[model samples]
Target: MTAPATSSGIPVSRIDPYTDASILDPYHDYRALRDAGPVVRLDQYDLWAVARYDEVYEALHDHEAFLSGEGVGITEQLNKAQHGSSLTSDPPYHDTVRGLVSRHLTPKALREFHTYIQDWADRLVDELVERGEFDAVTDFGQAFPLALVPDLLGWPVDEGRERLLDWAAAGFNAFGPLNDRTRAGFPLLAEMGAFLHRMSVPGNLRPGSWGAELVADAQAGKIADELLPALLGDFLAPSMDTSVSALSSMLWLLGSHPGQWELLRQDHGLISNAFNEIVRLESPLRGFTRLLARDRSLGGADLAAGSRVLLLYGSANRDERHWKSPAEFDITRSNAAEHLGFGHGIHGCVGQALSRLEGHSLLNALLSKVRRIEVGEPVWRLHNTIRGIESLPVVLRA
Candidate 1:
């Protein structure tokens, strides 16, 4: 099959990597890329975007064909000095580090944090119910999860929630072409990277926290000591942002559609499925990249080995090939569980269960106390990799 031609005359992705356009609203552009064809070469970054649903799933699933180690979000040359990490490597090296990561972040371990999770929810709801008004994104969605993750990781910071908020905004800046969006974030990225490196050191964590557990796992032959630092950075980097972003997106969905919210209020048991549907509606992030380990064919396109392909996760969830009337956000929709919001395959998100649990606990708490989430004029954050609303003003009529 012939290679998918790039939209040469019209730049495929002109949005600045560091600007609000990508962060504020990417749906229109994502639609453009998807409708253009299965694979569109981004003129700005000179990268390929796998826009169709089938192609993206194939890209992420065919690990043998698509390698992830060369760096997905950030270019290889930018981070070539980096050794290996679970996220950046393909197995068996990725498998090795990921095994250790999965151990600490596995289902059983997250269940152990259930007590802490419940406490965080109760505290946030308590604080917000008193005032009866707040920006759910920052006050709770963002603020609450941000507080939970760093505490569990034992990150060394007096104001970790605030600092991480800034750092996360700046962290996902290089997914596209370099522009003011990405260039302005270079300083923050460097500072955060250095700070994170220091925090990943064994000395930086409390003895009982997961960071220390990872250190011990390395000491006990679970993973290499050298890789442990990068592994720890993985947790700190994605944990708060993804979950919090998702939570914010969920609030946006629930608040905007009162009927669905009412349906959820009546059947509080559907909280789990509700979270999945929200992801189906507005995924936390659009895509992730995988390097082609070798030549492989997918979605009628024969991709060459070593080619970098973006797994358009957001597109996949909405793919007509997958879900019925995929565009509509139906909380009670059957088969909603099949969507790969957290991703699929061995490289799928390790902290997903933790994120899901947080989602359930927060949603359940809201349903128990409030009738509906009334939101107005929500503002979305500007970032290249992540997709989420930043401001969701709501007034709970308790």
Candidate 2:
């Protein structure tokens, strides 16, 4: 692998994952990486970054060329060692666990939850509207998803929402590094693990909820009992961060952009399209490393085998090559789904339909109540990986 040198002729700084400035505000770093050439090696992390739009898209589409089982997480060594999580696995075995996951998460199954999603959204909006002021993150973002996911997954409703929230936080935290990101994540992960362990036992998930159905799937020789913990853990771990953060990002954009907010406020019919536009502008995950399957040419760069590659979804969405005026956040972008926020290919997000449902439900409810999401100064949560707001205060305009 060629040593990575920045445009300034200095090698990139690979420091403790938590403190690396490039990882902090990666947009600038993405510009440098993408322009430095197709596959610039990062001397710091010793990883190759594919910051250009075309390369990341090609890599995702040609999984046979890039290969995911090696791990989508940063470390090449870790990617190689991974077994059977839907987020990491590639094919064959990946399809098995993913198929089991799909049995309950299918579009029909997802639609089954729309009434529940809208109910939660409406109830929360009603409560917050009555007060006329609320913390968007805690009062609504965290509450709505936390309220619905456990019930939908068939976890016992008792303190499950709080537990699920903690676990989900830790799970995303673990994705970044071993410092505050990974270390602070243990308790939430443990709580989620314990809760999921109980859920995995006999008679937990409702006979229909996928989590419960997994137990039956296990009995029917579909999924092994040993993998049930990880399967359920995947739910608590990956489900909330994107949904919560994505919704937070949407609120931040619509509230901050009065025109955009009013467009939705006017029609309410554009809720789904507006949600897609928001995600296109500000995706939740920044970029993470992937290992190259073999030495190959990608997006005008020579990508070598065994080198770690950075898949910069956030940066790529803004690439000028594919998007006309990519940086513009027009809610009217014709093909908002063209953005890689949900990713592409087999390893792409499986829960995207549910994520969309949450957005649709939330937006529909918000349009009914808020004439506009009055903006307050926003606070960003700095995860090494997830791009999201931690707290966004809003004034509800009825």
Number of the top-ranking candidate, with lDDT as the measure: 1
Off by over 4 Å in 2: 1-24, 76-82
Per-residue accuracy of model 1 over 90-154 as CA lDDT, tens digit each: 87888777876677678787787788787778777767877887887878777766777777777
Per residue, candidate 2 scores C-alpha lDDT tens digits across 176-261 of 54566666767766677677777888797777776887888787888888778777765665568778878887778888889888
Location of the lowest summed lDDT over 10 successive residues in candidate 1 = 9-18
Residue pairs in candidate 2 whose N, alpha carbon or C atoms collide under 3 angstroms: 14-44, 70-79, 71-79
For each candidate, give its TM-score against the true structure.
Answer: 0.90, 0.90
Candidate 2 global TM-score: 0.90
In model 1, state the lDDT of residue 105.
Answer: 77
